[model samples]
Target: QKEVEQDPGPLSVPEGAIVSLNCTYSNSAFQYFMWYRQYSRKGPELLMYTYSSGNKEDGRFTAQVDKSSKYISLFIRDSQPSDSATYLCAILDYGGATNKLIFGTGTLLAVQP
Candidate 1:
């Protein structure tokens, strides 16, 4: 199975709607989880990071992790047109000497105004 899996969705929602993106992983060794947002033809910028199983919230973004189920989710409130972008879920494996990040197939989101 893939270390990390996410549905590469082109999800569309109206402005002010709530958006939820998710990912699943098979590796239990992953200790850090991160969510990144990327615009078309641009690099991704880190939005949130969580260590282990917990929930982290910042502004309109919230990241949740369930280590037992190996599932993670990112929730966005009051979604705006500017929130339209590709969301990537990544996990950091600390098993090796050099920690490496495995990214999921990003999900594209469009908030129509």
Candidate 2:
């Protein structure tokens, strides 16, 4: 199994729609879960990071992690056209430094005006 997998969605939504993206991982040793947002060809910006199982909220974005199922989710509320971008889920190995991030194939989100 791949260490991490995502749908790579070209998910489209009207302005103000709620967006949910998810990923699953096979590595039980992953302890740090993160969500990143990237615009066009730019590098991803860290959106949220959580340790183990729990929920972390920031502005319009919320990240949830379920360690037992090896799943993670990112939810965007009140989405806007400016929110259109690729969202990537990442996990850090238990042995690595905080800087090491293993990413999933990103989900593309398009918020239409």
Candidate 3:
């Protein structure tokens, strides 16, 4: 099994709705959890990163991590069409130059106006 698991969802929603994306992991050594948003035909941009357990919020985006449950989530409030994109969850493995990231399959989301 992969270290991280997330549904590859092409989730559709209306504008102004709340959107939720989730991932689960099997690795307990993962210390940094991150969420990235990618627009079509473009590179992914880091949206949020949290260490261990806690919630981080920025405007309409919120990222939550629960190490105890090996679960992580990203919540988008007042979703907009501009928010439509592919969301990826990743776990950071530290090893200096050898450091690597394990990513989920990525969830596609669309918000219609």
By the lDDT metric, which is better: model 1 or model 3?
1
Off by more than 4 A, model 2: 96-99
Residue-level lDDT tens digits of model 2 in 51-90: 9999999898899999999999999999999999999999
Residue-level lDDT for 97 in candidate 3: 78
Q: What is the total number of backbone clashes in candidate 1?
A: 0
Candidate 1 local lDDT, 1-69, one digit each (tens): 999999999999999999999999998878899999999999999999999999999999999999999
Better of 2 and 3 by TM-score: 3
Native-to-model Cα distance after best TM-score fit, residue 38 in candidate 2, in Å = 0.9
Weakest ten-residue segment in model 1 by summed lDDT: 92-101
Model 3 off-target regions past 4 Å?
none
Ranking by TM-score: 1, 3, 2
Prediction RMSDs, each to the true structure: 0.8, 1.6, 1.0
Q: Considering lDDT, which of the candidate structures 1 and 2 is the better prediction for this target?
A: 1
Q: Would you estimate the TM-scores of all the predictions?
A: 0.97, 0.93, 0.96
Clashing pairs in 2: none
Q: Please write out the lDDT profile of model 3 over residues 1-113, one tens digit for every residue.
A: 89999999889999999999999999897899999999999998999999989999999999999999999999999999999999999999886675888899999999999
Clashes of each: 0, 0, 0
Residue 13, candidate 2: how far off, in angstroms?
0.7
The per-model lDDT (C-alpha) reads 0.96, 0.91, 0.95
